[model samples]
Target: MWREPWPSSNRMPFTKKRKLQLSPEQCSDFYADQYGKFFFPSLTAFMSSGPIIALTLARNNAIAHWKSIIGPVNSTKARETHPECLRAKYGTSDLKNALHGSESFHAAEREIKFMFPNSVIEPFPSREGIEEYLSRYVNPTLLHGLTELCKHKPHNPCVWLADWLMKNSPNKPKICDGVTVEEAE
Candidate 1:
């Protein structure tokens, strides 16, 4: 139901896309938690009838913008009031409306999790955190490794550097968390 300015133009980009055919049970589970028992039967039936496309759009104020473009929940009202809206052209009635959009950012996150269980959703690292992580975990060791590579000038530089980094990385896991190498063996 959400529409945005063209992704190619850099307004909003589609971050994820999935094509899925839901079973009745799956559809029931998806909608029942939010819409409640009254609407679940018809909604689930309709949703499970065919393949559906789920998309994740990313940008600021995305939920509000999408709601504006999709118009009201009632397709008839949408046709009468906002003829340009997606429901006006594609929907049949209130429950049979052709598209679904998350009502809020939190709902978006929840719905995305339901649809894509394996996908990780989290806030981006802060600038300070990123800088600290780079300084502590990457910069000094990477600089030293690069200097060594430059001095050695190995014929297979990529492989040599990979081996060096693997061997020298401070973050590399030991044989056991608290045990010494001999104890672990």
Candidate 2:
């Protein structure tokens, strides 16, 4: 009864037959546009696999946090361990990790564009909404990494540390004594 409705969904199985294939935009527009061909001809074929929920998580190190949250991309390894991870919990194979995130900000921008062209995918922290900032806040070091990423540069631990400080400084966040996989390790 726990895994209702979504069992055997395409998302549960990351197979060649189930992958979504989005095409690149073709060139030569103006009355009759003719250039690009469909990249994944069968993306439409798998429409009813399941309903996917899209989440926009706000954290100092959003991408990295998400990567960690989802854990590694492998599934068999996920099964034996990483049970707390999204992949470890539900991923049937190497592909279905139950979530997705932008590898980079540029990619995030492009992907947001592709998925929701007119939809507003705002940066963390609304300019005017004070309460929202608490929920959508980012720490300095994490922001720095995102800045470096925008410039196409590699990240440094110092930047990551800065983000860590930003995330924990204001709240003086509690350190859990409750057992967790990371804590057990």
Candidate 3:
């Protein structure tokens, strides 16, 4: 996203320019300072990086749950991390802090449009979700948790996961009912 003080049609000032110059990491720090550290480089960077906010979340509690995960506007003002709060880690500055979850369902629809003008926030879309999720979840380890899940039960786990997926996931199934790990391999 591009952070210009004035509208694309209007002339702007230098402060917005400075805000724009922040590297993704510095931006992350800035937002982390606000408690956006655990959310979507911390959302503070992304917000400060641009003038508007947008999201095309799924129908399943995407807005409300995202808000819960985002935590309060003030990280210090909040109580628990909500256990799954996005701000528990990523937030930093209030001005540049991460995430502005839609206040209501209607707002989510409107905000999503403003944040995403094109068809959707798909791959190679206007904003960046891949980098966002990474900054939120990555640790020092080389392997993500999935590596252990893969190693522990390549055979049994797939079925377990497939069932869970069938029960809870919106994404389609990849592994067939009769397919074996060897076949997959």
* Candidate number achieving the greatest TM-score relative to the actual structure: 1
The TM-score of candidate 1 is 0.60
The lowest-lDDT stretch of 10 consecutive residues in candidate 2 is 26-35
Q: What is the C-alpha lDDT profile of model 2 across 1-185, one tens digit per residue?
A: 01113334323212111223232221111101222445222222222244444334455666787677667668678667677776777766554445555677766566555544465666665556755564455444356556655675436756755665655554454456763223220
lDDT of each: 0.78, 0.48, 0.46
TM-scores for all candidates: the values are 0.60, 0.41, 0.35
- What would the per-residue lDDT of candidate 1 be over residues 43-77, giving only the tens digit for each residue? 88888887887777776677887777668889999
Better of 1 and 3 by lDDT: 1
- lDDT tens readout by residue for model 3, 1-185: 22322234422221112122445564454334346335644454465554442334454556566566567767555435343455545455554434455677655444444434454443343336766655554431224444655666667776755554454332333456876323221
Best by lDDT: 1
Q: Candidate 1: count the clashes.
A: 0
Off by over 4 Å in 3: 1-54, 79-84, 120-185
Residue 100 deviation, candidate 1, in Å?
0.4
